[model samples]
Target chain A: MSDARTALYDDHLAFGARMVPFGGFEMPVSYAGILREHDAVRHRAGLFDLSHMAQYHLEGPGVGHWADALTVNDVATMKPGQARYNIFTNDAGGCHDDVLFYRLDENRWLLVVNAGNAAKMWPYLVARADGRRDVKITSGHGSRALVAVQGPLATEIVAQLVDADITVMKYYTCVETHVCGVPAIVARTGYTGEDGFEIFVDSDAASELWRNLFERGSRFGLEPAGLGARDVLRLEAGMPLYGHELDESISPVAGGQRWAVKTRKAAFRGRDAIVAELEADTHDRIAGIVLDGRVPARDGYAVYVGDERVGTVRSGSMAPSVENKNIATVLVTKAASVLGGSLDVEIRGTRHRATVVALPFYKRPTP
Target chain B: MAQPAGLLYSKEHEWLKVEGDTATVGITDYAQNSLGDIVFVELPRIGAALKQHANIGVVESVKAVSDLFTPAGGEVVEVNAALEADPALVNRDAFGDGWLYKIKIDASSMPDALLGPDDYEKLVATS
Candidate 1:
């Protein structure tokens, strides 16, 4: 299959971004280097082109009721203009994709899904709405573009471009506003641990908005970050990636995302299986492992307790912000995931000592 | 892009500086540039023996992990201990202070296919 290109493809090239194939798209993995971009997002602000993510508009009478039945989160309780993180789980309790639901109104809602799962999710949604008469789903995958400005100074930098008073906008809330004279939706949400805003605009106006942000945000140290930095930032923040921390074989409870899975309200897909698994307590759980050695334990490396193979690493990195720390998130047996417990991570045939720690390796300080 | 003269180059991008059977090995500037922001490097033990083109160590960048290959067969003589604390030296000065280790070469076991500076440059250019 041919890889798709985002609207900011040329802009990334002009900025000297190193391109790589990701999720069937030719995306920028890094520009000014991963460490520099990661540091920039932590210290100041960083701009990211997230246009490759899938966006679907679900609108009609009683769409909110239909959405509540479809996702694991309590979408019915969310007020208009509010956003919530959720997972679309299958009947077997395995997560198909972790999604963000934006309640535009009582009759309109938007679902932002992972890029790789967009095609699969679209068909699933269509099949689920087969008998419903008051709902419509339309994909805006390539028609729209998303730019995320993330960091400590992200709000200030974004405030300079948009006319809305974003200071009053709470986290996980979005507002319809004009940015750089273009109609857009600005949300105070981010995958990084710091505060930020994600702006959605038309594909044709994406380059102009990106350039304007770069030009205006240069004073605040806003650099263009790529997927490489995005990975590190998310890992540092303890956010789960789709293929890593979640997949068809991993349940939401095992993935440590039970907070987003609501089993009480009427019914939802995978609710029975999730509740059963919660009651059984037989599933493997996710834990944070800090290696004593410098060599990082990469994904798919084996985790062991004594000579028994316990689990596999889901995501691991030499966290840029954390000095001399090699951290990884692993799916280990429940018995071995206790805090302060010692385990071994085998990297290239060598067993290195690792300690199980809290979920997030880094958390932003609240002012 | 700087392949210093008088150094032997391996197809794997390592450079060897040999003087009286003692050879100093380090990854070339091109290799370091390709592997951006190296955070950690695991060097071979001082007394370990290595074969030509064999995996002798490991180098890790934030984005990926890579194996370090020895360009020639030898017994490890000295490993760069400074890199243990600061592996970015490989990125800052790959050809100088970033030299990985020194190996005592076996006279009869030297590899015959080591590239010269000009040939190594051409190889990298085409690659």
Candidate 2:
């Protein structure tokens, strides 16, 4: 509870935002209202302060080999200025953390780690530096703050605001450009399943950039979204949250992150254990459910089938923008993983019935 | 911030409008404004008896769930069924169309506990 607050504390107080502790930081859960901010990200764009996340730059020869062995994604083939969402797993195939790897050039890469486990992932990567004479490890340096602007109109609004030409940056790509006179890097990757960009800049200048974004994007219905809306939006997008879906205790095979696992090549840290688990048929799987009604089957609620308890819901919400129903991701036993399996969430001393459904309760219209 | 001239509000933010033996109870305009979105409203059944400041129902927002307590003791005469189907009405109109329930109140205890408009406004300003 005594964790140091961020630089945006004053801004949050001025905006009358309700602050709550998350990942040990006093972060805003909502401002201007939850549904109002939620709809803004879904319909327009949202400005999220991602300053809590940790970033690092890796350089020198054979960095690709180090990255390829460190993460579950195919980072060796990443072209210069390209970014790929990746996952790092333990020897038991359990994910240590999920990260985004950005290729700066040959033998140089930038990685963004989760807030809580940023320091934890650093040692894991450093220990696996494949035959490197020197590997630079810098965590939380130079106020490497980031802002995620996500929605259908995010690109258009950001392009209008930043001096950089953000038009040509393809999805999962990064470009070193000046945004609003601040030297920054804009990456076309985000948690919400929409056309968006994540901008990285200095901390002292981030608030100004954020204020500028809101001022310019106000005409397009942009709102300052908080962690509350961010959670629901990511859930609706079926994107796996770090603590909910990936943690040190849960293996990637069970966390529904096999797409990021590259087991076809030489063995990585978690490759052996992942192969063994994939061959076996005992591990639990993550499943999505759209509850029968608007009442959410929140975190830690039980998931059941008639008289049998099968799983527990990790993250859930009654989506605000569209589908306005309770949707949750559940860690279910293998037998209860079927789509038609019925379930119920015990909320407020009442059991609300639900049904197992497909993922991505919401997605942007294809352009 | 609007506190109707005639209505009495509770410290917990519930408002009551007494008309003869019946009292209409709902959260105040300030309460709804602070709560952001009203996603689900769970109201008590008609004919249920309740005590003053007792838990009558629950309201679920996207962020959290809050318990709803009544300001005065009464027997539920009628519950707002429209709110159960569309809870957003509470956000759109917290006082008029969003009135939660109508209770035939115990007329004797009604006048002493409720806060007047000026008092409720001052209470919230300090909070």
Candidate 3:
């Protein structure tokens, strides 16, 4: 199959972005460079084209109930204009996909899922909705486009393009408003650790929105960031990527997302399996490792202690923001997850010492 | 991309400046630009012997990691110590201060396949 392109493909090209294939889409990996782009998001503001993320709209009577049954998050408790991070678990208790549940109204809902999992998630949702007559699930995959403005100044910059007052918009909330005269859903949510807003608009108006945001955001130092910067930012923030940290074989609970799983609530797909794992003490857990040198412990590299293979690295990098630290997220045995425990990562056939550090290597100072 | 005159280049994108038996080695402008924002560089130990086109070290950028291949067989005499603190020199001055190492070339073992600037320019253009 041919790789897909986002609505802002031309815009990325105009910006001289290096394109790479990601999630079956030809996406921009970097613009000025990953280091500069990553620094911009942490120090100032950075714009990102997130149009490839899958969007599904579900509305009708009992929609919230249906969504609650399918997702691990407590959907029924979410107020209008609120969004909650959730996970769709298979019957085996492994994560089908990590999703964002946007409660538009009492009966209307929108689910934003990872780009790679869109096809699988769509069919899975359809199969679950087979006997249900009240909820309607509509795919908005290629029809909508998403642009995120993230950083310390993201709110101030995005406020200039939108009609609504977003300065007071709390995190994880959204409002349907007009951005640069284009109808959009302005949400105070982002993957970066910094404060930000994600604006969702029609695909056709994406370029206009991007241009206007760039023009208005120029004074605020808003540069166009790419997936390369986004990856490091999310990793530093301790958020897990789907194929890396949470996969079809990994449960969200083991992936350090137990907060999203409402175990006390009624039964959901994979709830029993997840609960069973939680009851067991032998489940592997996700932990952060700080390597001794600059050589990163890449994915699939084995984690060791003495002669024992304890785990494997999920994501690793020479963190751009943190000086002299090579950070990695590893899936290790529960016993090896103790904070400050020493371990070894075999990088390219060489053993490197690593320490079990805190999950988030970086955190934004709350203002 | 700038390919300095009088420097011998390899198909692997490494450039070598030969002076007597010692040669200074670094990647080319095309190589550094393609790698993008080199954050770390691992160099070979002084006195270590290497074969032509052998993996001598590694260069890491924010986007990915690439192996640095030796252009000619030699024994490492010295390595650029500045890269330990700031690896961006590889992106800024890949042909000069970014030189990875200096090696005493083995006169009898020098590879015959090294490309001149013009030939390397053509090679890079087609690639």
lDDT string, candidate 1, A1-367, tens digits: 8899999999999999999988778999999889999989999999999999988888878676777776688887888899899888888889889999888777788889999898899899888777787988888899999999999999888897898989889999988889999999889999999999999999999999999999888899999999999999998888999999999889888998988887786788788888999999988989998899888889999999999999999999998766759999999999999999999999888899999999789998887
Q: After superposing candidate 3, which stretches have Cα over 4 Å from the reference?
A: none
**Candidate number achieving the greatest DockQ relative to the actual structure:** 1
Residue pairs with backbone atoms closer than 3 Å in model 1 (clashes)? none
What TM-score does chain A of model 3 get? 0.98
Chain B TM-scores, listed for every candidate in order, come to: 0.96, 0.94, 0.96
Task: Give a tens-digit lDDT track for model 3, residues A1-367.
Answer: 9889999999999999999988778899999988889889998999999989998988878777777777788987889999889988888988889989888777888889999998898898888777778988898898999999999989888887889999989999988889999888889999988899999999999999999889888798889999999999999999999998998889998898988889987888888888899898589989999998767788889999989999999998878666747899999999899999999999778999999998788899989
List, residue by residue over B33-95, the lDDT tens digit for candidate 2. 777788889998999988877898888777678899988888999999999788988888888
Of 2 and 3, which scores higher on TM-score? 3
Model 3: which residue pairs collide?
none
DockQ of candidates 1 onward, in order?
0.86, 0.65, 0.74
True contacts kept of each: 0.87, 0.80, 0.73
Task: Please provide, for model 2 over A1-367, each residue's C-alpha lDDT reduced to its tens digit, 9 standing for 90 to 100.
Answer: 3755665667777778888877657788898887778788888888787777777878777677766776677888889989998888788888888889888777667789887886577677676664567555556533677888888889877997666678888899998778889888889999877789998887888888888887888788888888888888888888888889778878877888777787885867788888988899688888888888767677888887777888888998887644587788999998888887788777777778888877767878887
Model 2 residue A84 CA deviation in Å:
1.4
DockQ of 2: 0.65
